[model samples]
Target: MTLTTDTPYALSAPPASLSEPLEGSLKVDIALVGAGFSGAIAALMLARRGVSVALIEAAEVGHGGSGRNHGQCIPVFGYLDEKTLPPEGFVLLRDSGRKVFKTIEELGIACEPVQKGWLNAAHDAAGLERARAAHAKYAGLGKAGAFLGPDEVEALSGVRGYLGGWVHRDGGHLNPLAYVRGLAGAAQAAGAALHVRTPLTAISRQGGRWLLKTPRGDISARAVGLTVNAYGDAAIPPRLRRSLVPMRSYAIASAPLKPDQRRAVLPGGVNFSDTRRDPMFFRVDESGRIITGGLVELRRGRLGGPTVAQAGRRLARLYPELEGLGFTHHWSGMVGISARQRPAIFEINEGLWALAGYSGRGVPTTMALGRALAATLVDRAEGARLWPHDAPGRIPAAALIGFGVQSLRGPLNKLRDRV
Candidate 1:
């Protein structure tokens, strides 16, 4: 099955050619399934350490969530209480965003990365309080964050209704597809073999190695890492599949804004998303057009038409100046949501690993997780310091609960917006 869907990023970026699909049996120290940011970054890291790595993808690189997200790269676990995070997880989340930026710079990946910062605007008094508390928590940890009152929020966002918000100075945005493609190139250059259009049909262990069977051939490796995220299929273990709920996320891109409109909206070119349960995020793209996205409910295995219309309406409400503006593109993709609403790292089998459930914070977090996983595979001592040794277990009926919550959240979010 074709995994890639037509999206603005796929049309704009130059096509990348990593390599042909696997045609015969190949042996490597590690075989990474999925060519999204996580798999590609892990491949690059491992290859740089002189490990034989084979990175395989079912479709073109970044064809999944990596290429279709809103592109905001902020710290993770934003909606969750800080006290619940494990010490190692806390450290990883705190440093992941910076690690992504540093890696991009050091690798010279031209992904149009912008470090202006991310603004978490508050839609109501309660939202403002939550933002303030989050800011205080980050501040207590020596992270640079600021609470912007109504006036400051309006000045920064050019939107009038926000009561207040918090700004994470270290957070930013980038062109995700370009970043993933660049990772593919970097990994291949570092001596890792990248096989595109190669889907793993099944995997089994034999003779202390993993045999990943593809349509054209098989790959033998000491270890396997699955980074397919929401696009995971029956090929993955049932435990991993049951641990995530895939939700459709919809986005729209407006025609390039006129000079006056650009000056009045997001003048500093910062990205912003509200603190709503089902939030809306907007950022000024490279072409000066407003790119916005929000959660949408799926019916009959597709995002309902009204859900897309609601997104456009939400955009207009936030920026009345751009009301009735022409949209250049509309697209949707699936994101993996965990039961606990946090990212999940699972060791599916003794030598097999997987990471998913970014919960809409995949950009920076995925790369960071990939690096940690690679470090662990390359050198246990070095990797253990960056990631926890305990792997996450399956969450019972997570998919059903997640879907039900999302289904209920849609109308409630619309009502909240009206209020």
Candidate 2:
């Protein structure tokens, strides 16, 4: 398989048909743009229902944020308790996330997923209070795991920086690329025509069917679903554009640590993150490698990722026991954040739809949204209910404001230390 932007990341190359140059215009019952989890799952659902689907990609599948993200399967609804979220929004997010997680387990995709849950560590006195308050709000939701005090958090995380933590047993981790590509393979098996290296230049309705103009070829279908969240280079529905803002973060992996060291770092090999607007998230890999990530506003503009030393230094600050650990790899990717910091799924036109903006929580959300979108397409009577159509809004100038925000993160951290 030759991987293209239209395919998933786990496949180094795209499946045969998609890798080759498209000869001429083609036609299908449904045309999909973007090949990440959402698009891939949508394709699979439609194809399984006997819809002839064509999927177009601008780059190799999973190359975007889908493949480049921290592989945490967190479905705990962190945004639910945040001040930015509306009361009804919190309930919706939590319920929706729960449904998504259940669906993945039911499907049995086997992407090495674990439903152990997440640890939201409080790094300060104020953070501890917030953690307790967060627990009160979600207690009625009846999630798994216990909210711990400072001492308990230290015992679990093996780090002293945390004052306390909230543990949601329903959250977990997995190999993101593998899970996304699995959906692609399933879609192919369902009879969808997958096209890679074919970027959609224009999408418009003609004679009732949606016609998508691509660099290599064109696909005409009765309906279209645009899933390109961050790479919104095409003229998309105005609301989607306004709903998502692309922000970058950096991650680094350390060489697999010896058993003792790994145990000393993360006792249960659990994934954890602090309670910062711009947070530092990390977890131990299957190989026992400690993977750590943080908001690296400093390198937002420059091309390469943060050095191992930079990541190491941050790790040392949080987990001083690993001050001497050596890192193995470093990378960075974009995350689509909505102005309201929530995921949205809605129809743009009569048959055209979109599902994007997971904020930093894409894995489970995308999985859930993709399958929901697929179900909606199969039964239009339920489309509006599944993913209600809302007015499209404009994304503020995130790139510009993001640059400034990133630049200030380091200074802000320093100031907090002094206080």
Candidate 3:
């Protein structure tokens, strides 16, 4: 089958459609836009707390980048450091995968979450040093983190040419589309009304509450949470999209490998991503297929163009079994880049918030911070906490800068590997 943009290989099957569009005016304590991972979790948490909440989505649940990724459940952030994130936020980030998996078990979400291990491998001297330092930081957080030698990496993962790396046993992979759908369902059951195919066209303070305009009807709520992110370009305000530098993260999946072929790569059940500017990451999914890819476009644009040929070439570099392997699917999703390269809850206005810009680490990070955002919505705390809120700032000439970044990625990787 040919690769597609609308229907990714990870969510090839038709997802059960969510609730219909808003048909009449409604009032709630809190209104959330975007039914992806962030909004779903936030809505779920607020609902459980007995807060009247409504989750509104432009499309069905997980119809955005949430469903289209390679589905790796990475716990730690590469770009986000302790100094960058708050102490409470650091704890949440460190135990991210465990928290996500715990919720999956408690809520009985059928996302197929697995926990073998997740590795951050290094390719050269600089990368080796970074990995060692990262391992020490991870070790300080938990005992599940362990460093591996070059030979050990080669043995655990059938991939060669790696110096050393760190692995966290709690991190693994999951079916993100299903996870989002499950969370939406749980949130609905908990009394959070979920409205799908409901795009927010306008929002302004009406009286004491915020009035959100939709295609079919209008909604008035005391507070609003925007989790639209990259997919929010058309669904949300133009200014919201401008605040984020849009980028596409692409992935290609090889034809389901034979049992023996699958066993050869990532045999230790660890997902592997190298230490390069333009990194190559791969993992064996439950279907026995090797899924991997990370190539942003030359500009802030789309997820539906064409899969890069480079993805297939890099896949073959890791496992000999995948050499000359036919790719069964190719897909891409847009990820929003923030100013700080960390997760932030942007305070767009009084009682109007936007939570986004996870870069490419949305799967694990969203769940941890989503809960924090929910708490802040209910309790107006005076001090800093797990979910840090900031004023929204637009990236000047984001498209031009994004183009320059993508163009330099390849050369930067080559030069860095040499050093």
Candidate 4:
């Protein structure tokens, strides 16, 4: 693989090639747009169940946020702008990560799965209370998220300044790009027709089937699922795209830390995210590099670069031993900011469905939701029971998001946390 500055560090090794676009017009039992986490899993499950399915992608598999996430695979929802979550959503969220890990073991995917657990470190006493509350909320649902006092927090992270934290042993981190690509490959081997660089340009209902238009040709499908999340294009309904506020998220991997430095920072190989709303999260890659991320400050369709700079500064503050290390990789991706702040399944029209808005929990949760989606498409009652979803709603001032609202996210998040 040709190395580029924008290539994520998680995919340091050569990647498995996804399928090239199809040649002629085709039909399938279900046509899934976006060969990311949800689409790949749905395609795999559907094909294995004796259903003909086409998993299509505008780019290669994991080309979107699926491959570009922070690699934290926790099974809890964060940043939902709702007062209460529906009961079914909780059940799905609780079981999501296990399904992801199970598939990894079953498929023997080499995505570097680490089961060391995740640390939600608190920055202060108030943050400590919030951490406890967050842990308690999940613990009530039968999750084994244990609360950590100051010493445990420091001991696990090998860093200072955290007053307390919570450790969820059930959750861990993995190389997301490798997992999605492996999943797409497994789906292809299982009889799902996988296509990359083949985008759905338009869609309509003809008679009883859905007509999907691609640059390749028009393909007819008995059912259609748009699993593009924040990457949806004109092919989907306006509401489906409009319901999300695409926020810019950035991540970077520092040049490999020395053995002593690695031993002193994130030494446990666990993912660590702080209690701030604009939270700081980091992990350790197999290369012994410190992988971390923050919100991007964009200017004229390009990165302003200060976001990664701030991330480096913040890391130094937390772990002064690595104060001068420079980053070897820095890249940004759009995270779907849901109107309600949680990922949900949506019905665009009869026989047409969408899975969008993962907030920050796409890695673990997408597998469960994707399997449920495919199960539902195959007319299994289990899917409906697994993820009964909410109706779509437009984000107020979502148009402003294209203006300066997205640029304002960093300031707003920091300001809100100050209050």
- Candidate that scores best on TM-score: 3
Q: Give the TM-score of candidate 1.
A: 0.90
Relative to the unseen true structure, what is the Cα RMSD of model 1? 3.4
lDDT per prediction?
A: 0.78, 0.68, 0.77, 0.78
TM-score of 2: 0.83
Model 4: residue 412 alpha-carbon error in angstroms: 4.0
Q: Model 4 — which ten-residue stretch has the worst lDDT?
A: 1-10
Q: How many clashes would you count in candidate 2?
A: 20
Better of 1 and 4 by TM-score: 4
TM-scores for candidates 1 onward, in order: 0.90, 0.83, 0.91, 0.91
Candidate 4, pairs of clashing residues: none
| Candidate 3 deviant stretches above 4 angstroms | 6-18, 78-84, 298-309
> Cα lDDT for residue 320, model 3?
64
Which candidate would rank higher by TM-score, 3 or 4?
Answer: 3
Q: For candidate 3, which ten residues in a row score worst on lDDT?
A: 299-308
For residues 128-175, write the lDDT of model 3, one tens digit per residue. 988888788778767355689988898878877899888877788877
Alpha carbon lDDT of residue 344, candidate 3? Answer: 71
Clashes of each: 0, 20, 0, 0
- What's the distance in Å from true for residue 399, model 3? 2.5
- CA lDDT, candidate 4, residue 102: 80
Residue by residue across 225-334, what tens digits does model 4's lDDT show? 88998887776788788888877676777777898888898777778899887777888887777777665555412443554467678888888887776766767687
